[model samples]
Target: MVNSVNKRGEKILIGPRLRRLRTSLGLTQTRMAEDLGISGSYLNLMERNQRAVSAKVLLRLSETYDINLSALTSGTDQQLVGELFEALRDPALGRDRVPKSEVEDVVGASPATARALVNLHQRYTELSRRLVREEGADEAASALQGTVPATDLVRDVLQRARNYFDPLDRAAEDLHTELELRRTEPLTALIARMKDHHNTVVRILPNDVMVDMLRYYDRHSGRLNLSELLPASSRRFQIAFQIGMLEQRSVIDTIVERADLPTIDAKRLLRTTLANYFAAALLMPYGPFLKAAEALRYDIDALAHRFGSSAEQVAHRLTTLSRPEARGVPMFFVRIDIAGNLSKRFSQGRFVFPRFGGVCPRWAIHEAFASPDKPLVQSVEMPDGETYLTVARRVTRSGGTSSAPSQSFAIGLGCDMTHAKRLVYSDWLSGNPMPIGPNCYLCEREACPQRAHPPLGRALAHDERARGLSQFAFAPDH
Candidate 1:
C-alpha cells in the first residue's frame, strides 16, 4: 500500500517550529497534553515530526496561542535534511549494516529513525575518534609532543567550532573600519553592526521559554534566541554572534578559507563558529578580560556580569585566552549534558576528555541537573595522574517554545587543576579529587563499572569480578 505522505520540506520545519512554540509558552508534554487534550507521547512524536502536526492540532495552536499559521508552516526546511544526512553519515549506524542511503530514506520517511539518527550519528563520532586515535597515532603523538604538524591545527580549530556555518569573520579585519570595528573594539563594534546593519535580531527570550541550552541561532531569518535567565556570561556571547556577522563577516570568511574545511557544510558551520568566537572576544576582550578573570578569580558569574556574558560563554572564552603572547589563563573547557552527551566541548590538553563517551556520572556537573544555575567545581586526576579542575553547572534548552510542549537538558564544564588556579572560580578546586570526568575506554579509570569498553592496556577480568580490586583490571599504557 502506498504510504500517504506530506512534503519533506513541510515536515522538518513543523517539527522544530512546533518545538519553538511549545517552549515559548513553557508547556511540558504533560502540560501541553492537558491544554491540547493529547497524550504526552503523541505530542512528543508530533513535535519531533514522528507524527505530522495534524491540521486540527495546528488550528488549535493557532487559535489558542494566536500563533501565525505561516510560522507553523514555515517549519519545513533544508536544515532537517542536513541534520538527518549528518546523522546518517555516522559510521556506527546499525553497526555499519545500514547504508547511508537507507538511513536517509528512512530518516526522510520515518520519524522514529530520525530520532534514532542522532544516536547513530553520535556513535559514529565515537567510533571515528577511536579510528582517528589508532590510525592518527602520528597526529596524536605530535599533539602530545606540542610539535606542529601539517593539517593538525586545521582539524583542531575546525573541531573547536563544532562545524557550524558563518559566512563572515576574519576577512574584514583590515576592513574592520568599514564595519566600524577597526578603531573601536571588534567585539563591541561587531554587536553594534549586527543590530544596525544586517537586521540580525537578538532577544533574550524568557528563561522559561528556552529551558535546556544557552544559544540558538535561526540562520533562515537571522535571529538569535537567547535564554534571558542564562548567566550574563553566555548572553553576551550570543549577542556577539549577532554582531560578529555584521562586523566580522570578512574575518570569519578568512578563517573559513585558511581552515580549508573539506565540506561545504563544515565551512558553513565554521563561519558561525568563528562569529561566536568574535562575540565572546567582544564581551571579554582578550587582554582586559584576562585581567578581570584573574582579578575576579575567574568567578564566572562576576566575570559574566563584568563582561555581560553567560557561564557557557565564559567557559568557551576561557579556552581562547591561549594566545601565547597575551595568554590569559590556559585551561580546557568541556560541556556535557545529563544524558552523557558531550554537546559542547573544547580542551587545552590541560584537561582531557574521553576519545569516546559515557563520562563519569559521579561528577558534580552530572549532578547539576538537580540544582539548576548553581555552579560546581572539583579537582580531579586522570589515570595518568594528571590533575585537573572541573567546573560544572546546569544549562537548559527549551523545546516547543511556540505552541507545543517543551523540555530541558543540562551540561557539564571542566578543565585542569593548574588552569583552575588561573580561573576566578578556582577556590573550589583547592581540595581533594572529585568524581568529575569521562568514562573508561577513553578514561583509563580501571575501577569504573561504566567502562563500556576497556581502556588501552586493560585486561578483561572475566571471573575476576568475584575476587579482585576490579572486574576489568587495567594495566598502564606506559
Candidate 2:
C-alpha cells in the first residue's frame, strides 16, 4: 500500500475524490465501507475529510474496486483550482477578492460545481467578446452566436484527454514496428509505404509550382505533392500525416465520435489534430521515445536529431508522454509568434493557460524572441506560488526564400518544479524564481515592470506627483 503522502510529503486528502468515486459507482457509504472492511462512520469521516484515508484503506479500495491509486490523487484538483482562480479574477464578477483557501475548500467539497463555475465564466466571456465585436448587438443574438470556437473546443478536448491518445499511440506504435522504421530511414520508408499501401505517388514539386503550400494531396491523381522547400523532417511528417488520414481513419473517427462535438467544423479540426498526433507518434514511438527522453534528459535538439524530427516536433511530442506505467515528466508546451500571439498550447499537468488574451509578459517565452535560436531557461513562480522550470527557444519554419522569409516562433516547454530536477535545464535554476501569472488581467502581482494592463477588479492608484516603474499602479489593499 502506498502512503497517503505524495512525493512532496504533503498529506493526501481523498475525501472529495472518495465520495465522487463512490457516487460514480452508485454505492452507498455503508455498502462501500462493508466492501472495504471498514465501518460506515469511519467511511463518513473519511468522505467528510475529518480523517485522513489510511494506507490500508487505500489498498483495500484498490483491491476491492480495481481502482488506480493515482486516479484518486492526481493533479486534477490542482488544475481545477488554477482554472477557478483565473476565472474569478474576471472584472465582470464584481466581487471583492475571494480567498484562495475558500476556492480550495469549494473544490475539495465539490469539484463538479467548481468546474461548472469555470464553464459558466468561459461562456460569459465568449458572449461578452461577441457583444463587443457586434457593437451593441441584441443579447439574444450574442448569446445564440457566442458558441466556443472550434479551435478552443479542440484545445479543451485535448486538454481533457491530457494530450495523450492511447488508441492513436498504440496504432502508431504497431505501424512503426510493421514498417521497420527503427532499421530504415523514416522518410524513405514512409514514402514507400504510402506508394505501396495506398497506391499514392509521392512527388517533390518546385517552389514556383507548389507556391506557398508545403504539402498538397491530389486525390484524383492519387499523388502526394511536397514542396521542394520542406526539410527532410517536415517531408517525413507530412507523409506520415497523410498515411494516418488514409489508414487510421477508423481509429480517429472512433475518438472523434466519442468526443461528441457540437459542430462539424470542430469535428473536422479534431480529425486533423488527431492525424498530427498520429504522425508524431509514428515519428517517435511512445515506449522508445520515453526511454530516450529519460536517457537524454529531454534535450529537445538531441531528441530531434535522434528521432529524425524537428525541434518543434520533438517539443510538441514531449507533452504527449503520459502513459501511466511508463510516463515521462508531465510538461506544458506553448508556441507563440514574434508578435506574442499564441498559436499552440498544451498541458499534461496542472499548469493552466489563459482561455482568452495573451499570456503574462514576464514569462520567459517572450524573452526567447530576443536571442533567436538560443534556448533560455527560467524558474518562474505563478501567482498561486507554484513554481515551474521553463525552457524557451525560437524555431524557424522551413521553405524560406529570398523573396519570402520563413516565419519564426518561440516554443515554451515547462514542467512543475517537483519534476524540474529531471530536466537538463534545471541546472540553470537559481532558487529565486521570476513571478508570473496567467495574464495581466488575472495576475495580481504588484509593481510588475512588464505589466501591460491593470489587474482586473482592482482600482488603479494614480498620482501625478510620483510614478512607479509600472505604467499602472493599484491600491495596496486591492
Candidate 3:
C-alpha cells in the first residue's frame, strides 16, 4: 500500500493516475483544482506527476469522487521499473554492466524513452527469434519464409498504430452520444439510426439464403443482410459495424491511409478492422466502460451483462482501454484454436505474443479446454522473470444446425501481476507461479523438461557418459 505522505511529510506524487481519474470523470484541471481548493498550476503539476498530492487534497479527492485511492496511486510506476529491469537484461543490450542507479534515473526522468527502449528490445527479440528459426528451411517448406502473411503484416500495421485510433474512438463516442444510447436499448437505437440516417434496412436472412456468408450489404437496395447463424450479440455487432462503415467511413479511411499499409489487401483488412473497432467502441463507450470495469473489479461476465455483450467481446474491449486520459489496466488478449493456432492477438502490456509458431503447450490457455466453459486462472512467470495473472476460457461458435460444423476457440486475457489483486480471478490463485515461455526454439531456459528444440546459437554437447535433467544440454557460450 502507498502511504498518503512520505516520512519527510512530502506528499505522494500520483500525477498520472490523478490525471487519469479526473479525465475519466470528464473534469478539467481548473474545475478539479477549485474543488480541491488549490491553484490550477499546482493541480497541473500534480496531474503531470511533477508534484505529489498533499494529504488534504487526497482526502478531498476520495470524498468528492469516490476514487479508488489505492488503484489511483499504484502499479504503473512499478510496472515501468519491472519492464526496464527486464529489458536491461537482454544480452544484446549489455546494460547488465551499467550501474543500476543510472537505469533508475533514466526510468524516472524519461519514462517514454524507457518504454520505447523496451519496445525496441521486444522487437529485437521477436525478429531475432524469427531469423534464427528460418535459417535453414526452404521457402516452400515454410509458409512464412519468402512472404509475410497479410494477417501478420496487418497485425504489425495495427501494432505500429498502437491499437488505438483517437479519431475513431472519438467518432464512436460522438455516435454513442448522438444516438442517446445510454438511456435506451443500443441495438434498437442503432437500428432506428440506420433506418433514419443511412436509409438502410437490416434483414436477418436464413442460413439457406445467406449460405456461409455472415454479413453482406446490398448497396443498390440499401439493405444490410446478416446470416441467422450469428447469435443475437453477433447480429447486433454486425449491425453496429455496418453503421461504422456507412457513417464513420471517413474516419476509418483517414486512419487506414495514415497507416500506409504495404499492400491493397492489407489496407482492406485494416479498413474492416478499424470499422469493427469503431463498432466495439460504440457498443462500449470508453469512459463508462472503464468506470464500470474498475467498479466491478474487472469481472468479465458482469461487464458483459452490463454492456449487453459477449464474454469474448468484453475481454477484447479490455485490451483497448488505452485512451491515455482515461486509461484502464494494460492487458494482453489472444484467441487461439484447439490446435494452437493464434487467430488474433493484441497487447497493451509488455507481453510478447508468439510470432513464429504454436505457443508453448505449458500455457494455461491450452489447459482451459478440460472444463470447456469454466475459466481457468493462473499466475505465470515468463523466462525473463516477469509475472502475469492470466484467465482463459473456451468460447464456442455454433453452426446453427447439427450438420454444420461448430468451432471452439480459447480466449486468454492477462495483465502484469502488480494489478492482479484487483481482479476477481486473483482470489483463486495459490501456490508458486508456473514458468512458461513464448516458444520453444527461442526460449533459453536451461532445464525446462518440456523444451522441444535447442536454442539457436548454442553449441550442444554430446557425451555418452553424461545425462542431465533436460533432453538437450549445451556447452557454455564463450
How much lDDT does each candidate structure score?
0.59, 0.86, 0.79
Candidate maximizing TM-score? 2
For residues 1-478, could you state the per-residue lDDT of candidate 1 as single tens digits? Answer: 1112345633332665666677878978788877887788988888666777666676777778887776666422345556776765443233345455555455444445576766676655554456444322446534332222223334466455432223332232233435454255544554556667767677668757776755777867967788755544345455656667665676678777886655465577767667766665555556567788778877777876665555666766666665545656556565665577765555555354544455666666667777885777667766667777667776554334456434444545555565566664666546677543356555656666544567643555466336444456654444
How would you encode candidate 3's per-residue C-alpha lDDT over 1-478 as one tens digit per residue? Answer: 3467866766677775677678878998999989988999999988776787776787788888887677654433657777878878654443245556767656655567889988987776665566535222233224333245567666766665567778888888888998888898887888888899989898888899998888999888989888889887788788999999988898888877876655677789988988889889998988889999999989999999998888998998888888878888888888999888889987545677755666777789998777786899999988889999999999877455888777888999999999998888999999998998877766788688888888766788877797777799888889
Rank all candidate structures by their lDDT, best first, as comma-separated numbers. 2, 3, 1
TM-score of each: 0.57, 0.70, 0.69
Across 166-223, the per-residue lDDT of candidate 2 in tens digits comes to 9899999999999999999988899899889989999999999998799999988999
By summed lDDT, which 10 consecutive residues of candidate 2 come out lowest? 132-141
lDDT at position 288, candidate 1: 68
Residue 269 in model 3: lDDT = 91
Mind sharing the TM-score for model 2?
A: 0.70
Candidate 2 segments exceeding 4 Å error = 1-146, 475-478
lDDT of 3 at 138: 34
Clashes of each: 63, 0, 0
> Which pairs, if any, clash in model 3?
none
